[model samples]
Target: MKAMKRSTLATLINATLFSAVAGTSFSTLAEEAQAKSNQLEVIQITARKRVENAQEVPVSVSALQGDNLDAYSSAGMDIRFMNAKIPSLSVESSFGRTFPRFYVRGLGNTDFDLNASQPVSLVVDEVVQENPILKGFPVFDIARIEVLRGPQGTLFGRNTPAGLVKFDSVKPSQEFDGYAAVSYGSNSSIDFEGAAGTGLTDKISTRVSVLVQDKPDYIDVKAPGFEKEDSLGGYNEMAARVQFLYEGDDFTGLLNYHVRDLDGRPIAFRANLIEKGSNNINPLYDNDVVYHDAASRSTQEVDTQGLSLKLEWDLKEHTITSISGWESAEIYSRADVDGGYGNDFAPTMGPGFIPFSSETADAIPEHDQYTQELRLSSNFTGDFNYQVGLFLFEEDLTIESYSFDTGTYDEAAGNYGLQNGYAVQEQETSAWALFGSFDYSVSEQLDVTLGLRYSDDEKDFYAKRTDNPTPWNGSPDFLEGRANPSDSHVSWDLSATYKLTDDVNLFGRLANGFRAPSVQGRILFGDVVTVAESETTNSIEFGVKSDVLDGQGRVNATVFYFQMDDQQLTAVGGGSNFNRLINADKTTGYGFELDTEWVLTDELNATFNLSYNKTELEDDTLAVAVCAQCTVTDPTYTIQGPNGPEARAILDGNSLPHAPEWISNATLRYTKELEGGEFFVYTDLSYRSEIDFFLYESIEFKGEALFEAGVRAGYAWNSGDNDYEVSAFVRNLFDEQVVIGGVDFNNNTGMLNEERFVGAEFKVKFF
Candidate 1:
């Protein structure tokens, strides 16, 4: 792929800006300015456990209010709505409907293992979600979502080496209010969501919310005996939240409950590609092939439940607060490999060969987790604020895996038998931490913050296997191992912000952070059990935030450098077998992030976010290949693999997988209110620079650009005190077919990428 020309990049940026300006008028802008000035209000909260301006939190944070989400979703967008809209944030899920990986400033987990730990932590209403499955829960009825970039280990002391995302739902109010919306779209898609709340008394209130969304699969199943597309994907999500709040003269109490049940077809995995010029077949049709014989064709069900409580007391000079929460989830799934059975015998040998039929190599796993956190925060009378917290977490996971080779069974030779083996594995881990932070105002124009945290973690693993089934598979059938390693360490961060002017601020941060050691499943398959060492990172950043153009626009920009010691990474090797996790000797990353929002006119708004990242392995010795000369023994030495027989020769100095060097997005929105209702038009474009998907980086895959445009036209009516709206919208108007990810993992026989589809929708709202 060739590098993009400077002129082309500039053209795209300018076009985006022009489109936004084209949608508004001067008269409308004047009216909007006057209206906003009259309605402007201040938002105060405890971002640092004290009342302060949202902009003075001393952190890189972005917040989206519930009304903003309602407007975006009404325009046919979901939580993914914020992708590219925020700097230093990107989200991508696997080929299946599993948990999505979120990257912040080029730091994230890339391993596909089920038990892998993520560098970024997610907190919903002060409740920590430990299971990866629960991380994918849909976002709804939220008061606001805050994305805090950079390490937050001092306040959120779990696995926040990268950053933290917090979601605060709309709690119960002492007033009667509710919202309901229903939408129907193409592909048999239907979405119904509603939330209602009422005050039982002057001091008590309750709220309930629910969501149901369903859609047909995109692929067409064509097997001889199956009625539906065997490889298509779909999802069903149901969730609810209830909250209670009580306020007294000196004390405030709040409690809430949340539950979610998700059942969906994981992302469908295509095993092989249809040959070129093969009758122009539909790409959505499944071919009878399996990559690892471990693939499955089934839906997974994940159930999550949690509870949270908070209490606050107003003292004479300071406020006292206590927060506690617990969350747990269970997941079950059955995958089907080999969409169809085929003849196992050599085609040239004979006609009596029978195709093996089996559902082996499938997996069923379950996990449980519990967490507790206690924190106290207060503000001193003279320009000082402080917070201290303690956290504890534990999790247990179990998996039962089976493999069967259902071909011609030779009774005499156990090796050529019809069955292979059954395996059972279990893993358990626990973690605890204590943290504190303080912020002080050194002068009228300068502010500073300092924070520190200490943590300890432990893990244990047990596994057992049987080649044949028998009652004698007893207590000794399992091998147990424990990793009781503990680290008593401290992490600290310091930041100083200076108010250069009334509308501008300059800030710089120096932070030391660490990621806990991760258990490597690959070690369980080898002769020695080795634990990957913890990773430590030092980051230095400087940035400016300003409200410019007479308060009509806001821009935030930052440049940072990160040095990581013993970075954890997963390296791919022969035949889908690889290291789950290992500590790279050294890795360095540097990047710049810029985000701006401009209210160009009353009817028009524009937002753009861009990120530039460059990461490189700093050590040369660790990149050396293990089998540099064993051509016959190394299965990945084929002509299609990196360097052919010289495969191992090309294993050094490559960019990490999935870490693109450049990514950007721009959006333009225009809204016009008429006598009947309102009309909204939005257009967004995203671009990602070329990325190397493999460890060796010999195979080059070009990045893609995508454009999504939408329009919402509606009519609303006010009947008595109730309101109603009817609207129609379309998404992906251009219908661009962009590839999300490409892989050539198995013998170069298959290529897979996410497909594009256009959708039209109708929505009705009653309030």
Candidate 2:
């Protein structure tokens, strides 16, 4: 009954929103309401390493600007907010907000290790962030954001089977400009972001930006004999960026340096809250703000520093560009993995549970990354254009993880002589690629784009056990080994665009992409070593970009299909929570995306986007681990399997985890001119269809449709040459409880979404 209600509610809300937008569009068309408030701005992107109108780029991409960009950052500076606003994108993280895993069109990796490789690529200012920790870098300052869908192999090279999220920060200019924003919200949360830029000389200009956030904990512990000192959900994080630009008669150089410091609590896992094979929260466990813990707090600390330089020189009819980047970080996080104390783990028993509480910690004290790229492109206006580039990347990382028993408990729960089980892993990776592309105009109305890249990657891995804490563990020196793996692949893409009219175009694209091989060696008390071969994907897509209703509306749509061979997947192994990397035979995905922006009136505007994708494993002999709390409903649920009792389920037709069948986001904004300023009201709604958290299809491991809404209202005015605005906003207005990920090894542990936020914001601009 609850599932029915939730589904019905989502359908109704979506239907209502769809009808309203359609009706408004039709009504405006009938009345000829093309009063031209603010025409949709032309979005320019660098998807092809050159500036071009997004509509003419022959790619399926979305660009957010102005108020939309501001609203997204205001909701949350993390990349997860991009998932909520953009269609065909989803993000999940087991290691809190610092390590986010992204999925696009149902293509992504489920590995949570620091060195895990992902098909989806994240690029900030043309620099790729290879590590999961670096992907969590905060989004700040001005400029635009672009989400490119489908396989971006030709330009991005390896690990781009899914696509890319590209961020372009505002640059310095000769004219001075700056802005500041501050907000205070519920749970004693505070957010502040500001940037200032100015020209120092005829050849030099600089800009500085900063972001800060503080929030108090909101969870209360109800365990017996445990006093809740303060909230466990609080956080204090700060990030800053400095950019310098030097412009010459024939050359230009831009340098950027950034740093982030964070102190907060990671995601909390709730125990035994999810029912078997379903998204339904067990009614018997109705508490939402209560948690049990043996420790005072689950704490985390992270520090990151990065520097990048871009240089370009004009060489007659062509331009030469070079980019060099380096980044380093250290992170430490500890959490209550069990979600409860002794009563929950070994109920009806005394202090016998050795851990007293199941606590896990991960630390990465050594991490470094370097990248260099050199490219040359045509600068002349002609029927043909070309670009060629060479790229090199290197990384060094070390991680230490521990699952320990609290000292307060006795030996009944099986505590060995050691204090905890610990593993140390070290990895070094190097990659190089050569890529080139050509764009030719077959005629006045037709264009063709061809691109190709050859990439080679190698990784050196070392892992060993530092401690053994389990009762059954006899080898204190559990595992110590090294692996050196190398992979080489060829990626290519072909596309053609035909101009149907001055205001419309049609395009089709075919692309192939690949990800490097992976190694998993986080073994202390369990299995030895596990490794997965490289994976590759081929995709075909068709799309249309148009400006309709006499410049009053714009629409973009695409349909795509992809097949992945030798897909890398994660599986649970042996005792002591060891994870193994394996390769599945094949998987396929098909989807469609629709995006529309309409000017309803001179003072009102509306934008709607929807994406639907379906994915399934094509390998029939593949068996996967079932949900920890699943109640076997499939008639073929057999216990006889080669991968132990826990891994006895077949996943042949299962949809990919974290891939929702449907995702939609809509926004409406209205502006009114006042005597002294402009007043505006904005609201947005986002919805996602049912999703599974793991490969196997089980009732308790899936969630039904989820919906979230936000609203902001503000007034803006100008004083001389300065601008100012004040606004009040509310995010997740209804406080929807959504489950994003699951921990199936240790009971039915799950992670929940953030709570509601209500706040008032103030901003000022000066030039």
Candidate 3:
């Protein structure tokens, strides 16, 4: 009976799709084809702070819709996983997924400091997330994701010397629509998410979304002191969002609230990755770590909440929009610092030598952020259009560090007598910007755009320390200081686009961007206070967007060159673990990117994306620390006279860290019509050339060329207005052991990428 029912259902779905397409009249089908011959599917974007067709925009931008975005994010709960699908983008996290750092086009910060600022900006719903911790909020229930290459200074302001990533959520709509995608994979990993929305009144609507991910441990525990089984590398995360919308005769308003909770173990690091001279991994190792002193298990939790309100009013010839937002979060992470058993270090530190077990705990117990923006835009149907806006932001952040005690050291005074007097620091930041953009269509085939922004930024920092043997409280004896630094700058961009034909556009753009001044005051452990002046970048870019093959294929390509002055870099000096900020004289780079999408036939589609970047520090005097994780690689090379036999792993003319020479992503999809449903197969491959993890490249901290692939086969059906799908998928199809990052601080610690997983997924949609 069950088999009969399944057969009947399949027939119903096949008939529905077949009739829907075959029932069309021959003349009507021909007319539809003619209408689509010279036009590609229109994709709308807000890259210019206003609604515009992506093809008509004169910027180098890539966008992915919600359905396609899920394909990338489904592999992991963190946003960093999307790097595989997007060219010109790379991400790595030293503190785990909650602190992912993003790099675009060879521009990014390699600092592990909590207060470090990134060149790339992450904007969600028009609100900027300045803190690195806040940027890790998982991405779910999104409307679209956009990546803008090069400097986005005029619109986004500071910390965007590289580019910007934008995420827009699906807003509340009058019609009810929602979907759920659930999957169960290897290691008992489960993923489930869903959203639904409906009208509450003639002019009001609401939407609610939730996401949950749970996974069990996969790594085994094999150590003398720890006897637990299956107790590492696991996670559970939950997130939800609510949105409300109201529309009146001349006004529209949207209110949204979101919350997230995460509990998990971050990425694991393997010790003894390499020795002193060479940059290769030691062969006498397995995929596991020894933890006789500790359980080799890390604990981390992050809680985040946010609220935003958006209001828009229509005037006779202009429109006004306002956005106000508030966000708060508390995060804590604790882990074994040494990444292995401590027995080997007993003879190095003398009579005080403990078993070498060490652990560090970091917390952001208090954090709050608020922002407001207002804009006025031209709404007239004319050749000239403009938008002027004001933006304000304020934030208070605090960070604390703790080290645990091990019996081999002082029990009363704490671990190595260094646990109690660790560190405590706080910072308050406020910023504002005034920006405007003008657009004019000079003629039917030519257009010009100009934008300018003036931004002001300020930061206040406070820090204190104590030397008491016990847990030290805030004391006056410890080095204490406060600093208030402020900076202001002007950024601008100019662009011109010429329509080569009805189906192609050629454009060029020149832009400038800046990063605000930075201050590091982790003075509790060390008495170092470092400050960096603002960094700026000037870019020149040219691009072309075209639709060919009778609208069956679309292509976008861009070439860009940029020069940055006073590039802020982090240097760990004075033989301490603390890092300081320094400014390099100059750095320059050039890059090119290409994206193409083709529909080979009625049933097959293909896409390809590629990017290449090269960058170098021009300042000959700049020498960066080498072998940060592994103290030994190429020890003999430090005997040069350039800086008096200094150990410099990163020197002048070295390509920027985390900058891969080549990155490419390709996808192929095929679909076939069935009786009551459709069957489809999809596959994708991503390749990245070798990448360095630190400014001073070390043999042990660089990843060789790696390729990752995934494949999925699915069946889809339609019942009335609802649709359903069942699919089986395999991630990391070849089980490639790609090393995404490394840790050289303690005996060559290395972090590996995700392992292979096979799973089945079910999805349903209704409208």
Candidate 4:
């Protein structure tokens, strides 16, 4: 039985990391160790938005304070557990929890076509979340999370040619702290989170946080008399924030407000590829079907709201700042594709099958977004710095799908009417930017930094087709009219740092980036309306940061090289379903990253992260015309003669779908501060080496090397100054069922992979 359930999940993750280090030495020696030297203070931030010392931020960033998010919530902290401990992050999703796809280094955009546009860009505090369903927004009370990488377009603007992910919360602080946690383990898992604040006077203060999680589905919903069998998916979150601060005199004002709501029901797994074997197939499968129903039951809802304002002045030489923001989001979803019998063979020979009694349902298509930004920054005496920005965005998307035909018998047009007419799109964007950066200190071990940015972009789109209830008129099915394009760009960056001593430092960077050209709703259902150009990149980097030993240990390394032009690839076009966002002709990528942390004593601590990526297609006639059309064609028919040009010449030179050319992540953490509150053990490993889910790579997907290890044990309580802690956690451990994502697009005729899950977790904190 799966090796006795993987030896009972590796003995419950080493007995929950040795009972959370023996309940932290029996609650910090029964509360009397003088709060362990004030919890060994030394956590600082600013991640370059100003304020320094996140290790002197000269770029290459990564921070995850807030008690390391409570020890990664017992080893499961979204974004695929921080992309397995961060090393060039990567995330993939195909409509599960409402689309998620992120990548850095190898860039990103798997083009699941929901209006494709994502080159790594997501900011929270400085607000900028160009709707990708808010990038799966979920992470609470975070006081930091940087991950800057490269090409931040001179300072984050435009689609950020591959870099940027910032989220900072936990503001309003005048004293009164906050913390609250709840957790339950094993299958019926549950988790609750909380936060609070005080200081409602002395210039106002407020903080609120909330998170809720539920677990139950892992597959097996046999219908009939439904009696459960792992039905997979669950998550919910609610948030709120408010703050106001003033310290007049030379002026300093701050105001903020935020709200968020998220609901999720995730579970989508499919893989039976006609019983495995097709060049060693194992897209994850555990089957038992009589008629057919692969499985997928989804629900996602998101609501976000924001407002921010800040102003500061302290002309003691020169200092000024201003930032303003507005944000909005709304999303709704529904998905139910119990594949079994292909939903009864798409109402007998597709072309718009609509059947599936029990009142068919497949919603999913309602999105709205709005954004605004304004910024002004300056700092004169201390080596010049400047910023200027303005941006606006809007979106309105819609999708309405209906299916039915539960085996014959209709009573007056009732089996189904709207097979699929698809329409509803609106996009508008505006931008303006001007940035500056300068730092020069020739002595004291050389220092040089220079930056610049200039951007101007505009886009407009519109589509319509409220409903067309079957009649087959073809041609002019949608997209009445609308398109306005405009673009202008300029990006730059330069850096040089040398301090080979002082614990080491040697940096180098040369950058340039750009991205602008997006119009949603599949250009109003094809027929050439393609306008989506502007993609450029040029980067070269070198880095090294050290603190080896004297500071207990720390190491960082980076190496990069990128060259792209006109590159805006998105394939899948051989008459299967339609999608093609072209512009490839030159491409190249090189990478290497290494991270280290070691305190290997004083109770021991260790950490390591690694990344290696290689991308190509440096022109070979645009990689054989992007691998000859790269499979995907069926925009309502069009194929005749010579097998339609040999299926577009089998999309020549293919390879670029979910671009994964050996990606790696590693983690090894250990902490033992027993005496009352501390004892942690961790292991997170990730490896991805097979990719090409389509884009003419004609179905060739493979995946493996996935591991998750965990352990946590805690207990703490300090009376005299009030503080509390409690813990217990267990995750995956060894319930390894692997396969985090899958695709068989052309092969197996479509859709495949995703399944296997195991759970257990518990946490508590009060301070």
The best candidate in terms of TM-score? 2
Q: How many residue pairs clash in each candidate?
A: 8, 7, 11, 40
User: Over the stretch 676-756, how does candidate 1's per-residue lDDT look in tens digits?
Assistant: 556666666666665544455432233344444544555555566567767666555555444344233322122233333
TM-score of 2: 0.92
- On a 0 to 100 scale, what is the lDDT of residue 761 in model 1? 41
Local distance difference test values of all predictions, in order: 0.59, 0.79, 0.76, 0.56
Query: Candidate 2 residues 589-667, lDDT tens each?
Result: 8767788898888899999998878788877788755544455333244464334444456777777878998989999
In model 1, what is the error at residue 610, expressed in angstroms? 1.4
Model 1 / residue 535 / CA error / Å: 0.8
Return model 2's CA RMSD, one decimal.
4.9
List the candidate numbers ranked by lDDT, top first.
2, 3, 1, 4
lDDT for 690 in candidate 4 is 61
Weakest ten-residue segment in model 4 by summed lDDT: 350-359
Given candidate 1, what's the lDDT at residue 669?
69
Per-residue lDDT of model 3, residues 1-767, tens digit only = 01223653454344333322322332244446544423336779998888888888999999987445767777455787767477788877877778888888889887766677899999988888888888888888898999998889888888899999999998999999998989999889999989999999999999999999998766655544444666667889999999999999999999999998999876665555444455565564434433323444367899998999999999969999999999988888877655555444343321112224446677889999999999999987889989899999999999886656443456564434235446777999999999999999999999999999999999998876554223232333356757788899999999999987676778899999989998887664456578889999999988777766566667777777789999887764322345677888898887677777777777888888888777877776776545433542322245453224545543566678788868899988888999889999988899888987766656666677778898889999999999999999887899877566765443455666677879999999999
lDDT of 1 at 19: 28
Clashing pairs in 2: 276-700, 277-698, 277-699, 277-700, 277-701, 278-699, 278-700
Ranking by TM-score: 2, 3, 1, 4
